[model samples]
Target: MRYTLFFFLLLLSACLQAQYKINLQINAPKDSIAYLRGVVFDDKNYFPKDTIRIKKNVVILQSKKPIVGGMYYVQLDKSKQRFYFILENNDNLSLEIRGGEIHSNNPRNQVYFQYQKLAKSFEVIDSLYDAEVGRGRKFSYSDKAAFFKVKTAALAAFRKKALPKLNPSEVLHIYFSALNRLDASVPDKKNYAARLAFLKGLDFNTNKLLFIPTYKELVSEYMGYYPTQADSLLKGVDQILSRVNCQSKSYPYVLNYFVQLMRNRNVQNNTEGFVKFVNTYVEKSSCNALSATVKKTLIDDAARLNKVVNLAKSPAISLPDTTGVTQDLHQFAASFDYTLLAFYAPTCDHCQKEVPEMDSTMKLIESRLNLSLGRFYVCNEPGVPQATWRKFISDYKITTNAKHVELPSVSDIRTQYDAFSNPVFFLLNRAGEIVARRISPNTLRKYFAEIQRQRMAQNP
Candidate 1:
């Protein structure tokens, strides 16, 4: 029993001290260097992690620490030639490279190489298939549809047969499974429940799957397919995070993913929902994956979001009118039924375009909606001389002729209104309450037109 315990202790110590080794046999000349790089998020994006120097056609890359598991490749410094492999949890690997092909001792690497070959083979075969169906013939619509059906079936069959034979293990297995589901998804259709289950059951503990290239594409497709409504999308985000182990590295990766996904304005518009997501998940997560600075930034941004986007009434500020006299913003807007709060810069080309477009939009809102509207344009640069502000207003035809103001400093505009970019806009109702935040000046005409159309539909 004592001997058994001693052996167990030795094993544990060995595992703790275990390092990574990659042995390569290449045709490069002696004294040549190679770069060891890796893929983490997107397939096309790679970053260097280490350097390996070759002597006499051989190189051994060694590390004092356990290398993080991911897909890695070795590229020659002076040559376009590269040797790629998918590596994870293995103590050591040996590869013989020739003519852009790798023969690896590690089974995982062998399987991944096979997978790559399969992908390339199918791509070549697809083009050939396209030619076979056409053969210099212009395909009719039915001919095209028939060719697509046959090609898709053949592709699915090839994958189904090839993946099972490759026999990927651990995280690689999960990636392939998710990839199959992704392949099954089409532009107008998907298996939502099955995909949701896959995500819910995914063990992020092995977090190496995060490095798989198309993993993000799968997640993106799932996010876009399931959520038809904005609220549903936000709730879906929370639901996914709720299943994650807060202390696991997956928690922070998934959290930041949703943050990035929501950042695309074309995807979602419920800034309040995203702010609450950040406040809830970011503040409470114990993952320790994010740096202290990043966590603080997220929390600060969430607070700023609530201040700018969640409030019933936007905070008031005083700024100088075009005449250089201080004017109250909310007070100036209170008498009007609705207000167009615009932030622009004197020199910004985009602001120049957006501000002028607002003229027609403002006119449409006032004439069609039959509402009392105020135009309050704020110059983002507070210290800009009144002459610059007046000239910009004149050039942009701010002939909305309501109120044009400027702040005292740029920092105040950035922090107070969260106007980091030029041409931020808001639509506000009377009583100083917000109707919409961060609207495009170009969309305002269509926006109010839709509102009037809805009103007529409901009343008629």
Candidate 2:
């Protein structure tokens, strides 16, 4: 009876052990072994001496030949703090963190350090992910906090002495990984400052060994995050741009940097700065050899910049109505004593909200003088379906006076008028001279009043 009880206890112990085993469901491609990297439980460990009981759900095992690519099962017990990865390869390329010792010692310390740092960072990421799973659409403040916490710890780890001995590519990867993690958190000016400092420390000038692709991505992300610090960012960009002297190889980066600079100037309303910057480029000898498309882009940018600077100084712009027929601005202006030409898009919500109010102002002025208001729904691009355009027009509930037509090109029109955003209104007198321009719904009333006063002064 004692012997029977001992056997029963042994069976019970086996059942308990089975209960602790985490089942992993792995789906791998044909002929490829799964390369497991993340956490796994004790029962799933693929170490040669470890006995792994494959769960029923785990199927479709593939060959481990060539071993570089595939999917693998990883069962991880978060509660028990046990983890393992089961590889299909019986040839012993598999690895596990058994008391901090890796498979080998030649550069194995570096590998182990990287793995441990990554594992810790991933644990934090996993926690954040769990916190975010159920909260839909709404901002997950707690998850954001967790993310920042993990990122801060990861950054601390990266700043340690061990990172310097690593390869240039590895060092860059670490810097950018931290940069990306911080970017997803709340925008902190301090974080941007720290990132810039970290980047400067890397001495990108000497470390051409790091992959160019990775370096460019880091630069782009830095540009995006620190837009307000344009001057500082520009200094970094200038250094990088100087190194990228091959125009054919570096034009894209240069073009994008210039574009970002222009946008930042626009945001700050530093129109004079924008004009000066572009003018310098426009006047450069290299500008002559630039592609037509690039030259045109520069011209468009310059014109827009010029217009913004001249907003309070310049008169209105009058463009022809491009309805069923084409007409020049001069011809169109001669027909009416006062012409209000408006460029708008049907899909634009701002245009939809503002156009009706503008139409009311036009009606008020129509009976007072030989004044007319005309709208041209400029096709944003060529090949926009007629049906789609018509539907957009109908959906907006715009009237017959507001005709639909396609502009030759946005860049051309914008350059000619110095217009930027839509539902733009321009006023012209009988002599085809521009009188005034209005950009907002609230400004329409003021524009009409000023135009009327001007007309009365001229006529009287």
Candidate 3:
């Protein structure tokens, strides 16, 4: 009797060791369409209720309770079909496929065949698209007509089947691909225009996938080739901007693009229109803070241009001097035919190299013409210990001719000037208006010459 009891205990231990135990529970609405739970074994699907024995790397899932050994599959009521899988103990495993067949469990031969077919299709379609777009035809159908035909058919197939179901990211890919196809060599304006019109009509608000790239493309095209289409482009942009509700995330990119377009394009003929558009949009925009800042920037920029236009008639200056001492910019302006306001940092390498060059130029121009140079240190390392500030000043020998002063409000100065980088130079006339600004050492000489010419013309 003692031997038989011992044998029974050993048998129980062996049975428990062979079984892969799993616990499952359902915590979803009863009206769910479908629910399933399974474990992955060597990338194969294993239902918890199945009788087939699973090997290593096996996952076990169930619909109701714990399942002991072999894999098993469970189907809850079609309605309220949600289910979850749980591991009972520390089992080396991963879970997948709550509702469908595990693709990896397909026989290795079938997997190989599917992959080969996919690769061939991808290669053919990719080649056709590239050839069609790359053909140096003035018109779409002029060169590589055969390739274009193939590409069109393939694209249509993709759009009809995939576009409706595509997520935002996928839609963006399609839009970008279409844009890439619109090249300078393509003579087919009608086709390109139609494509763009279609993209413009896409529901960017509900599907954010194609919004940014589409906006960018429209901006580029407007600036590059379609100045005549400004009204239409602006309308499209207004619609897009309305949908971008997240200011902190989206405003910078959109604003930067607008600023670039305004700066690069000669939109003066449409200045009134542009200004009205900005004012109306700014008033309606959710980007109140950004809008205010941009408006100020635009106003200041316009004011500067007005000063330049009135350079000969009204030359006046009111900028602050070093030591926070207010000086009539006109004082330095009239004394020197050309004045350079050097914004620099003592520790900046570019400043170190630039200051001496500026000093040499000042010396060269001083005798032949009335020229003055004043340096502003733009103390970037503000609030440092006094000793550190003094040491930095001394190390750079900044006192030679330049005046040193801490910015009255460093934050304000940075924001006002947009001074993210160091060693900036601004050229001013007798009117204290900025004639030019330079960041590169190479460009400084050219700007200086231009300023000198302008001054001579004014004085002559």
Candidate 4:
């Protein structure tokens, strides 16, 4: 019995020692809460993960539970003083702050410290250039050229000196290498290839690159680059995916980022691209990086998009009016040259603002084109109380002539229409074909005004 008790104590000791532990010394007063934060792609955002109070000298943070490997920051509670570190499960770390420099026994932190120094130095020079421009200081062509040359040389020197210090086998080395930024003013950047080429070469086998600002900057550059039309954007997303390993965290991040990016865009085939991206890259992928719930949710969203997406025939919808009588959408649309369908939730802030504008725009359309408000149809999404819908209608002062319809609870509204991001609009021609989608109130006014002017010129 004594031997068994001794063995249990030994096991407990081993279990306790196998935890992720860190001894950190920061420049703060006694009992201050030091927050352990996960660094997001934006270096400015340090999302707090855990916190512990600081002892007089060192704060030893430990958890028997595993912590995922990621770049993180240590911040004093409500203070600007912070430091960054790359951490992994069960990593033994010892660090101290002295004379504003971090002293660490961990070799990885040592390399990251070098990287941070070089990065900060580059940023200082970059910010000076930005401030010069922001101040509206004008530079001659030759002067600007000289500044570019100097800036490029400075970056090159920083990289060259820091290159030998990084071990090639280390994952931190790969992350550091991705931190190099090229001047957007360079002529090569006019081509999409130049913007994405740097990120394409990174070692995505390690997801450490995902947490760094450099990778995200290049990603934003590539995504936000000019000619951001549907095909170009889709191709840009594909290029990023081709370079990243499907098994890595980068796969889902890139897939979901671009999918959501293109979802709201009014460009032609943007919805198609959104669907194809999620289906082909993610649904077909064998990697477990993306959660099943997220994958299913995105897939279901893509399906909903297909229902009312631009250029598709408007699906058959029969909804009840505020008077407890049902109306057929196709039959109502037949009486008009065009039907404007608006789906909105009563509580949606954007819907509340837009619905009023829509009513005023309809009045303008009546005055300008001699069209009646009967052509406009405003729909309240299913599942909300009728009182909320009535309140929205009353608050917005919606026109009586227009059809104010409500999709009943336990209806096909979810399957037949997209009320996902409420206040979505679609312009349908008399043939029940979707002519334009997400048509705003202002846009509707402008379009009919253009048509009215063209018709007047034709008659004149």
- Specify the highest-TM-score model's number: 1
What TM-score does candidate 1 get on C-alpha atoms?
0.66
User: What is the per-residue lDDT of model 2 for residues 1-460, given as tens digits with 9 covering 90 to 100?
Assistant: 6457545644664554432222223222221222333211112222222233323223222232333111122333222223332222222232332332323222523353465557665675667566766553334444455556766566556545454664534433444444444344443344766555545543333232221233444455445444433354455455555454434333444555555565542223334445555565543536344577876787677677677456442233333333456545555556666566666665677777766666666777676655665543454434556676667666656564554556555456665555556666665566655555434443445556666799889999
lDDT of each: 0.68, 0.47, 0.44, 0.66
Top-lDDT candidate index: 1
Residue pairs in collision within model 1: none
TM-score attained by model 3: 0.35
What CA RMSD would candidate 4 show?
8.5
Q: Estimate each model's TM-score.
A: 0.66, 0.40, 0.35, 0.63
lDDT of 1: 0.68
Report clashes for each candidate as comma-separated counts.
Answer: 0, 6, 13, 0
Over 328-445, each residue of candidate 3 has an lDDT whose tens digit, in order, gives: 5445555555565555565667667766566556656654455555544445544545566566666656554354545443454444344445655555666656555433333445
Alpha carbon lDDT at 235, candidate 1: 67
Better of 1 and 3 by TM-score: 1
Q: Which candidate would rank higher by lDDT, 1 or 2?
A: 1
Better of 1 and 2 by TM-score: 1
